[model samples]
Target chain A: MFGRKGKKGNYAYTVARVKAKKSQLMGDDAYQKMLMMSLPEISRFISETGYSKEITSMTGKFTGINLIEHATYANMASVFTSILDSATGELKDTLAADLERWDIWNLKIILRGKSFGIDLDSIREDLVPAGVLDAEDLEKLMSLDVDDDIIANYGRMTGVSIPQSVVAEYKAQGNLAPIEDFLDKHHFERLLATIDSRSRPTRLYQEFIRKIIDTINLETILKLKLEGIHGEPVMKYIISGGKDIDKKLATQLANAETIAEAENDLAQLDMYEFIKDALGKDTHSLKDIVAGLRRYKMKEASTFSHLYPLSIIPIIDYMLHKENEVNNIRIVARGIDAGLDKEIIKGLLVI
Target chain B: MAADLGMIMIGAGIAVGLTGLGAGLAEKDVGAAAVGAITEDVGLFGKAMVLMVLPETIVIFGLVIAILGVFVLPNM
Candidate 1:
């Protein structure tokens, strides 16, 4: 019912409805209870919970974690497409353009799979299967014997200049970083692009993205430190638009006595406070921290929509929030397969 | 007669009252969101309370105009 004038309500309403569903996502208590159940029990639990319809329809064909993983992917894609279908105005266009980043991700994963000769079916399973790129287009690209345009496609999709620069790098190196870089550049640029300056509604949205970019930069820097990659090279990989985590600053942090101290330094940056809240001094596990950060990004968007009911903010918010819930379910399913403790797996969840 | 000024005063009062309506409209979303977050976790009660009430600033702005309209404007 809420949208900018003359624009269709479908996208915004769907966004709101999906947000209500997102609120129903499993909490800590639910995860604790889930740990006490078996795979079949977990499947039943999901069916009784949110994925009930998908589970029942796909029943007898799949079982256990496999069933939930596939169902979660399907439900997530269905929800996302519904949002896409709901688009009405420039907001619709913007959401679609932003969503193209997923295709960039899919292309990178496909190309990487090829470089390693991983099976096509396996790689396909990893993709979101939703977004601007059509299934036929992906299938066509996925079948290319040569590497997927994984890099140039991002440049084209995001309207960035990197794909051309990376084309030669792709051919000579056969590494996926070039295309991946284009996607990275595209993501930050799109987030900062055409920010609705007049709308008070858009300010928090901007700050929210700044935090995501800043965290990604922090994660990259941390990875570099652990990998022992020194300043210049790691600096080259640093994505722009982050509050401050560029090479010189990162190098300064790298020289710190420990990761904790480095993070403390980052926390001192006014813009980098989100990182501190999501992660603390060397206490949380890396996987948990990353997942938490990812979830945090989605939740921040959700929070935005709630505060400012106008604009396309809520739609994007629901999109990310729903994606994380799907990811969490997949993680729980996978963890169960590996026979890990329920508490440990739950601990890793961002919820 | 100065009766025209009385009409102007009433119109101003109505507009001033609307500021409260606008403030309440804004709080509708803020309050819902804060409670949503709180329902997810009881520990969030404190932070959510602060955030939910944060938008009360709008009402305070409205109230300032309201008081000025009564005491200050009447004297003027």
Candidate 2:
């Protein structure tokens, strides 16, 4: 128990504000309404909600689903930044570290953009500045010519160690997968490293991250197996530090003859009961599994927040809930724009 | 009689002080969570206020005992 002594900031006030925002997050009913509307109508519906300011500001320049997508990303960044500003002490550190995933994401985006020779303006448009990097830092990164030296410089500037070998491998293979894998691995390894299992809240946080790692590893294995790839190559992509599945089990799961067999192997693990339904149907794709994992994580966070209301769990849960809402809305809007059917688009949503 | 009066006064002081401490401790978490709930929905102001003060009952009880000790019990 981290005793409530010398703990800076007023979590009560922050938590209260977060809860207020959480309650206002759009529900299934709103999504249903948005699903039927045209792209412009979808944008209008969003303007009436929390996203009104961003939508209004961008309306002149961008329109349709593109405007909605950019607005959603921008709003997410602002909301997260506000949360970071409100937090202090351990909570702030935890949130900052957790949010650093966005930095990794942005780095990946930049790398991918460079790989494909995409222009700076397009790359800049795709960025979601929800991490430690402020807009100015992102602007600087975007302005720099995409190459190994600039990438290394970006890493040094951000204090994120992008291993030279990953860049070398990217150069050798002329592919982004190696670099992406390295970044993903680096992020998770660093994330798991920060979590101290001694404290209850942190231990819960550790479990949350571990579950995520496990899910990522499982999805990787399933995807690789489906592609008729297996053995050591599959093992290379599997992230460590999972709670239910260890390295050996992951390797075995990866080597399994089929997806169903892999799911069967997972069924023997502790988290089988929770993830079984997601893996039950043969028709279930990697997207379904990933969505199931997100749902499970959210459910676990909600339970933890209920059990420990005053701690960091509730705040983290609220953050995840906000992210999910934005993502779901984006998916619906984009799906509608692409002329996808209602049910199909609905399936794409995590909510 | 002087010593007896001093002892009764000390007991009254202890009653109020300790119970007030207990009440403060109890209200700390409740008040925090109540404030949070209220912020989420302004309509919950009334409900949160009620919940926030519920722990004060302990201090009130303590005050009652202290008063009893100082006045009625001293005579008894």
Candidate 3:
């Protein structure tokens, strides 16, 4: 998928197909209906909707939550693969780059699982295998015993290796923070590098990427503030290339004496406006705040996707929506199986 | 004025031919998108047909101009 000659994209056909697929995504009403159903009924409903293939393939081996989880992962992987397959030229490159985050995601899962002494089987369950790394690649990564070995092999596999120093830090401190931070930075930096700024669509795509970087940086700062860590360490986790939160602004935000100060500074940015009210509310978890920010990003993506129907925005929009759909379904199915309250499950959804 | 008549015929041909090409170019993208949508949802077949044929009007306009050039202009 690399070094393709033509930079042209099949925007019209891809956008139309994606829009049709987007329309088929489950709506709020569907989620509400699912919320009320039992696990078996939800499973039946989802299988009938489109996941019948995945569901039937894993029939006897897995049941209940396992069945739903595995099926959703398989379905999402195939959908993502189909999307990448459907595009041509530069569009495919951009998508393949963006989707590489899933590989990083799977890596993170494996690292964390290995570090925490979780077994390979359970660790495999959380992986999406939606990126360049397929099940076999993940299986290969999972086979290695040492975390450092996994890191080295991952670097060789994807070519975005964490530095030996960071790996050493991870080894010494037993904290995956530095290494994870490196992976996040590598993901965005690689995306920035892959895109050329000449075309309008790509420039807009860069803006989208910048916005994502900004939000994630903001999220990292907030998480650090919550942990009560301050000064130089806070800056370490911040990813650069954000539109508003550039390196200078990031340093300033990091150097701020208190979390409240950071929040006040964040309140000035227009993108942060949506989450302004709930910034430091005691009742809300970091997950809620992050989810709120993600929802805002999705809204921005949706608006832009409509404005530029024949651009990369629509694909990004569809991908985000699809990912959210998968997450929402998983949440509902798992929540139902776990006997969680309907209101609680609804609260977790990004809709 | 055999030469003048010949030039008028050439002009008529050029108008129809160029516009037909333009219409075809315009329809290519739309037709692809339409087919894609139709594949995703067969229900969109009617809507896709409407959108796909909308470009045909360009060809019709070209045809009108060609007719005017060939038939009416000489009389004028």
Candidate 4:
């Protein structure tokens, strides 16, 4: 992967562009101001910033929370698409791989909507067109009638293996969890397959993916523990390829007697030092812990980006920051629409 | 004696040329990032310019050595 051609790829140019874009993301100050605004005021606030074009154009069609949410998603999709478009060679492939999470997200949305018989238009509205799949492919996937047809279309579009067993399990359970787990596993498998551990950039990418898997495992284990589920059953939901929480530790954590025990088990891992406070807090809710983990990961990504300025880490950092901004604004807009208190909404934002 | 002078000249040429190449290589990424930073906020132009030219010092040092080899050191 570190051949002459790979070396010649536009690392300097792409990283520079991404760094600039990163600076333009919403700061904590902006989010603080947004927490006090009503939905319309929030919309106006966004319109005066980087999201002006999207907010202005979407204002005619959508209003209130929907307007802000849709505009945010649209702007996110466009920006990410442009980033993908701007990249080439190995960088492009790495970015495309990273962005495939959006496709997975879109698929999950469709699957959930379909199972519940929600309208396709509503599902489409939630979709972010930021991955390898274009609008046409998503439209086709959305219009497909049967589960088999949808799975086939998804497999074809994403090249991710959707095993028949997952479908069978979904049918038997009447829940989307099986299918979602399968997709998550498949995504990580495909991601790990493409990345060469020998290359610095890909190695960093791999490390990031492993951390995500570890975080997901920790979250799942904690949630299941809270639900009174335990033993080997919980291990089934734990995705593989985690850096810190290997299969043995995952099983141990899953089998821990209580959430505190699970926290102790996690404390033995490398991330313990970083997450000690969050895990140690007696009053910390599951949601707060999960959000704390995400924040920690984002901070880690920022460090990696600074350390390796020309690597894929900076681009990933930029994308994560952008995603956080989008999610934060959505929380504020929706919180205002639902008449939630400013402090509550502010607490929900990751910033 | 003429051959010795030619070899010294070649040594000086290599020093300047390779150092210039090294400086160029270092400057490439810095320049790109600077341009990107400037694109986001024009206020960074001065800072970017300073950073973008920082690697040129390597080339300047190389040139000084080359000058010494060619003019001053040879006379000594």
Runs in model 3 deviating more than 4 A are: A1-6
TM-score ranking from best candidate downward: 3, 2, 4, 1
In model 4, what are the clashing residue pairs, if there are any? none
* Higher-scoring candidate on TM-score, 1 or 3: 3
Per-residue lDDT of B1-76 in model 2, one digit per residue for the tens?
8898898899889988999889888777678667767755788788888988888899889889888888997677
Candidates in order, TM-scores: namely 0.72, 0.91, 0.94, 0.90
Tens digit of lDDT per residue, candidate 3, span A50-102?
78898899878788888889889889888888878888888888889999999
**Residue B76 error, candidate 2, Å:** 0.9
Model 2 per-residue lDDT tens digits across residues A81-187: 98788677777777788888898788778877877889876676678898988778877777777577667766776788668788789889988888788878888
Chain B TM-score, candidates in order: 0.72, 0.91, 0.94, 0.93
**Which pairs clash in the backbone of model 1?**
A151-A179
TM-score of chain A of 4: 0.93
Candidate 2 colliding pairs:
A20-B40
Give per-residue CA lDDT, model 1, range A31-133, as digits (tens): 6677777888888887777778778887777677767876777677666776677556655666676676677677777878888999876776677667666
| DockQ comparisons of all candidates to the true complex | 0.05, 0.55, 0.78, 0.56
Predicted candidate 4, C-alpha RMSD: 2.8
lDDT-sorted candidate list, best first = 3, 4, 2, 1
Give per-residue CA lDDT, model 4, range A33-56, as digits (tens).
Answer: 987777889889998888998988
List per-candidate RMSD values in Å: 8.1, 2.6, 2.6, 2.8
Give the best candidate by DockQ.
3
Candidate 3 docking class: medium
RMSD of 1: 8.1
